[model samples]
Target: MPPLAIMPVLRFDPAAVAECISPLPPLEHTTLYENHNCSTSSTKVLYQIATHHYDNGVFEMKWGRVIIICAIVLSIQIASADTLNLTAGTYETFADNRTVQITANLTDSTGYPVNGTRVNFTTDLGNLSASYNYTNASGIATVNISSWDIGNATITAEAPTATNATVNMTFVVGPVSKIVLTSILEGTVNTTHLITATVYDKTAWEFANDENKWRIMPDVKLNFTITPPPGSTYNSANITPPSNTTNKSGITTAIVRLDKCAGTNGINVNVTNEDGVDVHESKTIIGVAGAPVNLSITANPYNVSANGIDTSQITGKVTDVFLNPIISTGSVRFNTSGNIITKPLDGTGEAAISIGPSIFTVNVTVNGTYLDEVGNSTNLTNETVVVFYTEEPARIVVTADATRISTTDIPGVNESAITAAVIDRWGHVLSNRSVNFSTTLGDLSSTTAITDANGQATTTLHSDITGDATVTASTLNDSGYEINGTIVIRIMNESFVSVITNIEPDPVEPGGIINVTTVISGQGNITGTRLAAHAMLALDRSGSMDPDYYAGTPLDVVLVLDRSGSMKFLGSGPEQPMTDAKTAAKVFMDNLVSNAQVGVVSFSSSSRIDTGLTLLHSSDNKTLVRGAIDGIYASGSTAIGDGLADANSMLVNGRGDARKITVLLTDGVCNAGSDRDCSNAIAIANANHITIYTIGLGSAEYIDEPLLQRIASETGGTYYNAPSSSELRAVYN
Candidate 1:
C-alpha cells in the first residue's frame, strides 16, 4: 500500500530540475509534473501523487531520495522575457493606405517552438487586420497593418496566458501621394512671382468619406524646374530654391523671375515617394508686357536742306518701365504737317522712316500702339523738332566745348573740342565740304576733316602751355572764296596769392604793451578786374623762428668796425687784431645770399663810410665789397656811438623792403665823442626796426662788455665776447 499523505511540494533550481527528475522510471511509465510559469534561471516547484510504491514496496520521502516514477512534464515560461515578438516586413511606409505585414513569433524558454498559441495584437497608430491571432506550426503569427495618418505607429503582440510574453515594435509612416502647384496667372516681364506647391498624403479607406483623409506632409524634399515658352532664343526665367523641403503646412514656395522679354513660363515640381516612385505637377505663368512708360523720337542730321535729294532718318522707340523694349506686335504712326505714314516695329522695338527736306522747319510727332504677350494694348506718343535749311557754303561759325581749361601735359587732361559749322547766306547748312583746322598753342587731333550731313566738322585740341589758344577753321565755297571761322580757348595754369603781414614792433613779450602797425601785402600771379582780397594776420609769440626762416626775403646788413688804437695791437695770434677783424668781416659777407646787400662803416675818433650798401648780386659787386674790407686800418680811439649812427644811416636809406641788420665790433668803451653815452644811437636803431649784434674784442678787462650787451639786448640782437683774435671769425659767424 502507498502512503496516504499527499506528496510534499518540492522546490529546485531550474538548472537542477533535470538532475532531480532523472531518477524517475522510464518515461512511458513515469509520473510527471508540469510548471506553466517556469524560467531558465528561476526556482521551480514540483508536486506528485502516487498510488503505487517504489520497486522495494516501501514509502520514502527524503532529500536526494531516488525516484522510481512515471513520466515528468515541463512547461517553460521565462521571467521578464519576450516570448511573443512582433516585427514588420518594412519599418517605414507611406501614409497613402500603405500596408505592412507584421509577424509575431512565440517560443518557449528552451528555444522550442510553441504551437497552437494565441497571440493578440494592438497598435497606437494605424489599423491591424485582426486583434488576435494564433501561432502556426512554426510558432509565427502574422497580421497586416495600414495607416493614412503621417506619424509613428507602435504595434504590440502578447500571449495572454504566458508570463511576461509581450513585445512591441515601431514603424514610420509618411506622405507621398500628390502635389498641387499654384501661382498667379499673369505677371510682368522682369518681375518676380511666387509659385507654391502644396503636398498631401493618402489615408486609410475607413477615412475615405471624411475630409481629414488627406493630411499635410512636412519635411518632404521637392524639386522645382521651369520651362520657357517655345521659340525663345534664351531661357530668361529663373527659379529660386530649385530644391526645398515642405513646411509644417505642407506648402513649399519657389520664386520665378522673368527677364528681358515677355513670354510664357511653365513651372514643374517633382517629388519622390518612399518606394522610389516620382510624382510631378506643373503650372503656367504668363509674363505680360508692362505699360509703355517712356517713348522717344530721334532724327539723324537734324539740320537738313530743303532739297529733296537730302534725306534724314527719323526713328521712334518704345520702352517699358523696366527699360525692356516692347517687341510685341506694334505699329508706329509718324505725322509731319498733314502727311502721315505707318510702320511696323522691328525686333528692337524701334521703327524708322526716311523724310525729305522741307521748306519750313518741320515738327514730327509719333504715336505707338503695342500689345503684350497677353494681348493687352498700350499707347504712347512722343514729338521731336527737325530743322530744314537750304544748301550753300557761305558763312562759317566756330565754337569750342570748353573755353577755359587747366594746362596739363597729359593727352586727355586738358582738351577742347572745336567744331566748325558751314552755312549758306540764307542760314541753311551745307554738307560734304572739307575744312582745315589750325591752332596757335596746342596740337590738333586732325588737321583736316570732312563735314558731316549736319554741316559740322570737329577737332580735339590739347595743350601743355598756358595761354590763349586761337583755333581757326577755313574752307572754300562753291565760288572759290575761302570762308574762315575762329574761336579762342584759354589754357590756364594753377595760381595762388600769398598775403604777408608784418608788425612794426615785432615779438611783443608776454606782458609788454605797445602800439603795433600790421602791414599786409599780397603778391602772386593772380589777376582779376575788381577782385577784392581778404587777408588774416597771425603772430607767433614763441620767438623760436630760425635765422634762415626769412632766407627768401632780401636782407640789408651794415658792418660797424672798431678802428681804436688797441685793435691795432697784435694779441694772442699770429695776425694783428685789425687783420683778423677784416678777415672775419669778409667771411660774414661771403655767407650772404646773392640778394643780400652789405655796407661797411669804420670808426676811430669818428665814423666814415667805407662802402655804401651794395648788393652782391654779381661777381663785380662782391669784388667791390672785398676791396673795401681789405683797405681798412686800425687807428685812433674807438667811437662806437658814431659807428652805429653811421651804420644806421646807411641802412635807413637802403632798400625799403629789405630786412635791416647791423653787426658792431669794438674793443674799448665809447670815449671819443659827445655821443659816447650811445643812448641816442641805440634809440635811433630801435626806432628804425634795426637789429644789432655787438661783439667785444680782446680780453674781458679791455672790452666794454656791459655796453656791448646793452646794445644787443635793446635791439633784439645777441652779444659775443672774443677773448682772442683767433675766435673773431667764429664770433662773426
Candidate 2:
C-alpha cells in the first residue's frame, strides 16, 4: 500500500500583516515536535512529526487539505516592499489661506503599482489635509497642504513598515517676492535696446513645463511698459509677440527704441501681474547721449612776451548736434610752433598753456583737438595768437685800426678803418640793422652800412686836413632812439723844417760884435715858417721847491737863486721862491746843450758860488751841480744886489770863447750888503759885456720889477715875471 499522504494546516490574519515585507535570513530546513493525547476504544491512533525544507524560507506542512488554503491566504496578506514617489502639482501658492496639492504614488521595485497600502504625509512648514491615506488601486494618494507663514515647505510620503523609504516634494507659499529685468541700459541715441523682464513667483520658481517652456498660471497676465525721460520717445514696433503676455516661464521681453537726445536719460520698465491678485515690479535703464558733432575753441591773452613766465589760456568746448554739454571728463590736446601743452578741461571746458623764451621776433599759431564729455573728441581746430617781440640797442661801440693818419696825398692810401658794433641789452648780436657813418674832417667810403651776422658795420675814413678828425657811427633802436659811437684820428703833414747855422769872422776879438745867423729851411716842401732860440735860464731856488714837484730834465745853465728868509714864505709848501728856484734851475740845466757851461749862485745877506761854471760833457758835472743846488737853504736877509753881482762875476771869469750870460733871480729888494742898490752890479755886468736875463719872483711888493727890467734892458736880455711856481717853469722854458 502507498504511504499515507497528509496536508499541512496553516492559518493567516489580514489585519495583523505588516505594511512591508522584510528579507528572510539564509536557512537549510525547519523542524517541529508534537505531543498527541487521544483516548479511543477498540482502535489505537498513530502520529509522525517531520522536518521540511523549502527555497523561499516557508515551511511545508503535511497535515490536511486545509493547510493549503491557509498558505494561500498568508501569501496574499504578506505584501511585497514598495517605493513611494511624492510630487507637488503646484510648487507655489499665496500664504493667504491658500492650499497646495501633493500627490504620492506607491510602486514595487520593478515599477508595478502597489495597492491598498496606507501612506502617511507630513511637512516641515505646513499642515497636511490628511495625515494618513490608503493608496488607491492605481497606487496613488493625494493630499492638500496649507500654511499661514510665507516660506518653503517639504512634503514627505512614507510607508511605516519600509525602512528609510520615503518620497519628498518641495513647495513654496507667499506673495510675489521680486522681479528681475535684464538689459544693457546704455545705448547711443536713436538706437534700440532688447529688454527682458523675468517674473518670480512666491517660491522664486520659474513656472515652466518639462521642456523649459513657460507655463502661464490660470488667469495670470503680465504688462510690460517702458516710460522714457522727458524730451525722449520710445518705440515698441520691434518687440516680438506683440502682446505683453508672459510666456510659460513668467518671462517677457520688449524692444525699446530711443529718440535722438543728448545728456543723460532714463527708461523705466514696469511689470504688473494680473493673476486674480495685484502684483507689480519695476526696473530702470539709463540712456546716454550720442558722439560729439561740433567743437569750438577760444583763447585769452592772445599776445604774450617771449619770457618763459608769459602764459596764455586756450579753452575748448565740445557738444553734440543738439548743443548740449557733455558731462564726462576728458583731455584737450594743444599744439603750437613752440612747446606743446596738454591739459584736462574743467567743468567749464577750458585749458591753460604757455611757451618759453624766444631769441627773435616770432608769430606763434596754436592748434589742438577739442574733447567733449564721455571721452569723445572732435576734429582739430586751430586759432592764431600773435606774439610780438621788440629788440633794443643796448650799446654802440666804435673802434679805429689806427689813431693817427697822414694827409691824403694819395686818395685812399692814408686812411683808417672804423668799425661800429651794435649789441642787444644781453650782449647778443643784432643783425640786419642799419648804421650811419659820418666824419668831421674826413670822407667816409660809405655813409651807411648794414650790420652782418656779427653785429658789426665798417667804413673807411680818408684824412682831409692836418688835424684830428672825428668819425661818428649812429644807429636807430626799435623805439626810434638814436645811439652813437665816436673815434678820433689825427692827421699830420709830411713836411718838416730844419735849421742851417752860419758864423762869420771866426775867433772874433773881445768887446767886438760877432756876426752869427741861423737860416730856416724846409727839409721837404714845408707849408709853415717858424723860428726858436736858446736862452739863459734864470730860476728862483728857495726853500719852496723842496716838496717833490713835477719832474723835468736837467739842463746846462746857471741858476741865480734867492736864499733870503723871506724866500721861505714866498711860495706854497716846498714851492717857495728859493726851493722852486732850485727846481727850475735844474730844469734849465737839463735843457742846455751838452757842451754848454752851468754855474749855481745862492745869495742871502751875502752871495756865494755854490758851483763854478763847468762843462756838462760828463755826468759828473751834472751830479756836482745837483749836489750844490740841494745844499742851498734859507737863513739870511735879502741881498738882490749881491746875488746879481756874484752871478755876473762868475760868468765874466769863465771862458771868453763861450757865450757869457748871467741869470739874475731874486724874490726881494736889497736889504743887506753895502751895495744895496743893484746899479753897481748891473754896471759891472755891462762892462764885462755879459748878457743878463732877469726873473722877478714873488708878489709885486716883494721884488723890484723896475730894477730887474732895467738890468735886463741894459744887458740886452728879456725880463720875465714869475708870480707862481708853474709860471716860473714856463718862464725858464
Candidate 3:
C-alpha cells in the first residue's frame, strides 16, 4: 500500500488496546495527529492519527491510519463590553476665578476597570483643563472647567470604539457682581418710603444678546439699612424686612419709615451671595416735612404788672401729626386787647412775642401758623394770657360793634352791641361791678348790669333814627369813685325806591319769554310825590331773592365768549359777531354794581382765563376787564363746552358769600372736542349752585339750540338766542 488515510471518530481508548507499541525508534515509524469531526461538547474532540514505517532499508514508506477519542481539559473565556460614565464635582460655579471638576469614568460591563482609554472632552462655555484625558488604573478620567463669564455650560465626554458611549452634563456659572439701590417717599415724614434693590450678574449669554443688559441672579439674599440725618435718632428711621431674597426678576423691596423734621438720609443695600461676594449700593433719600397739627403756648410770667415797664414773653411751639417739631420757615402772630410785637420761629418750632407796659387789664390772644415751601398757611390753636393790675375800678371804657346803623326797623339790620369795661386805679379789671347804661337815642336792652369775668358788661341798642347817638356807661369803683365811658353810634336815614315785580308763572322754562308786572313803592324820607329811579329785573337764578327787592348782595360773574372761526366770518365793526360780543360784554360790565366782581374767559377750540374775578369798585379794575374783552381775536373751531368749563372754574374760585353767575356766549355748535356734550359743565355748575346763562349768538343752523337750552335749564339759569349780533346787547340785558 502506498499510503493510508483514516477518518477520526469516537472509539475505544488507546490505553485499552491489546497491543501497544513503545515509543518509535528514530526513523522507524512516523506518527501524526490531526483533529477531525469535532463535537459540540468541550470535553470531546476527534483527531486523525497517521503512522509512517519503512520496509527494509530501501527507503520505501508505508502509512497506517488510526482513529482516537480525546478527553481534554480546555480554558474558556467571554469578552466584556466597554462602558462610559460622566460626573462633576459640583453642578454650579461662580465667575470669580473659580472652577468645577468634571470626571469621566470608563469601565467594562463586568465592572472591571478599563485603563489607558482616551476620553475626548468638549464644552459650550468656560475653559477646560484638557481636550483629551486618559483613564487611570481606576478607570476614571478628570478635567477642570472654569470661566470668567457668567452663564450655563454643557460638558461632554466620549470614548472611541464604544457603542454610542457618550456622556453629557450641565454646569451653572454666575456670581453677584453689582447692586443698585433706589427709594421714593409717598407722603410726609410719618409716611412710608418704598426701597428697591436690584442684583445683577454679568454673563456671556447676556453679553451675546445685549452688552448693556445684566444677567439677573435669582434667589440671592440682600440686606437694607437707612442712616438717619442730623438732629434725628436712629430709632426714628426703620426699615421693615431688612433681610430678603431676590425674585426671578433679580429685584427685592423693603419699606422704610423716616420720621424727621427735614434732611437727607442715606439708603444702603448689600448683596448676600454664597460665593462671599462683597457688593453694595447706596442712595440719598431726602426727608419730607409733615403738616402742623399741634400747637402749645406758654408764658414766662403768667401775669405781667400794669406798671408801665413790666414785660412778659409769650411762646408758641408747633408740632406735626407725629409729634415731631416743625423745622420750617414760619411765624406766630399775636393779637390782644393791647399792642403786640411778633417774631419768626426758631428751628425748635418756638416763636416768642413780647408784651410790655400794660395800661389796663387785658387778655392777649396768641396763635401760630405754618408756611410751607409754597407759601400755604396752616393755622394752629389760639392761646390767651392776661396782664394783671391792682383790683380797684378807676376808669370805664365803652365800645359798640357798629358805629353806623340803618334806620330800617329790621331786627338784625338796625341792632348794635354796646359794651362797657371797668378798670381799677392800677389798671386792673374789676369783675362783679354794676354798670349803668344810658343812650341819647335808640332803645337800650338793659339800664343796669353786672360785669362778667372779663370786667365787661354788654347791652343791645335798637334804633330807627338817622342821627348820631351818644351812649354813656358809668360804674362805681371800690373807692366809691364814679368812672364814666361813652360811645357814639350813627343811625343813618334810609331812602330807596323798590320795584316789586310779579310773574304769572313762578318757575319759567329756559329760553321761554314771559311778561312781568312791576309796582313802584317808596320808603323813609321821600321829598316829592313823584320819584324817578331806574330799575332792573336782573336777578341771580342761583338761590337769590329777586334783585329788585334785595339789591345789596355782592355778585361774582364770569363772562365766557366764543372766539371761533365763524365769529370772524361776519367781518369787523357792528356787523361782526366778535365786535358785537365785545361791545355787549363791556356794556354788561358797565352796568354791574360797584361791589360786583367780574372774570373774563375766551375760547377758540380751547379756553383761557383772561382775568380772575376782580372787584369793579375801582375804575382801574373796570378798565382792565374791558381791555381783556377787547383783546379777543376770533380763530380756530368752536369749543362751547370748554368755554363753559373755564367759566365754571373761575366761579368756583370766587367769593363763597357772593352770587356766582356764568354768561356763556357761543356762535357755533360744539364740534371740536369730546366735552361738547356739556354734561360735565352742567353737573359741576349745579353742584356749586352756580347759574349758567347761555346765549346763542348766531343763527339756529350754526348753534346747538338744544344743548344751550339744556345747559341753562339744568343749572337754574335762562337761555337767550341772539338772531343777529345787534341783538346781543339786548339779550345780555
What's the best-to-worst order under TM-score? 1, 3, 2
Q: What's the lDDT for all of these models? A: 0.70, 0.61, 0.69
TM-score for each prediction? 0.32, 0.26, 0.31
Poorly placed runs, candidate 2 (over 4 Å)? 1-144, 147-177, 205-243, 247-249, 259-265, 271-292, 300-310, 316-333, 338-365, 369-380, 384-733
Q: In lDDT terms, which candidate is top?
A: 1
Q: What C-alpha lDDT, on a 0 to 100 scale, does residue 648 get in candidate 1?
A: 89
What TM-score quantifies how close candidate 3 is to the native fold?
0.31
lDDT by residue for model 3 (1-733), tens:
3332432112233343212222324445443333422333223322323323322221122334432222332321223457888877877666644668888888877888778778898888778889989999999889888776656777888885344343333444357777767667334675577888877775534465665655677788898887876777634777889888989988889988775645667778886556676778888777756877777777778787665556566677777765666664565544443222233457777766555444444555544444443445566766756554556677888876566666756322366778898876664566789999999998899989998876789898877777888999998766787789999987766754433344533333222344465545454553223333433333332223343344488999999989888897663445568988899999999899877899888888877666678776544356456656766778898777888888888888889989999999998889876588999899999999999999987678878999999999999999999988988999988
State the lDDT of candidate 2 residue by residue for 228-258, as single tens digits: 5565444222333334655666667777665
Compared with the true structure, the alpha-carbon lDDT of candidate 3 equals: 0.69
Residue 601 accuracy (lDDT) in model 1: 85
The lowest-lDDT stretch of 10 consecutive residues in candidate 3 is 53-62
Give the C-alpha miss distance for residue 259 in model 2, angstroms.
Answer: 6.0
Which model, 1 or 3, shows the larger lDDT?
A: 1
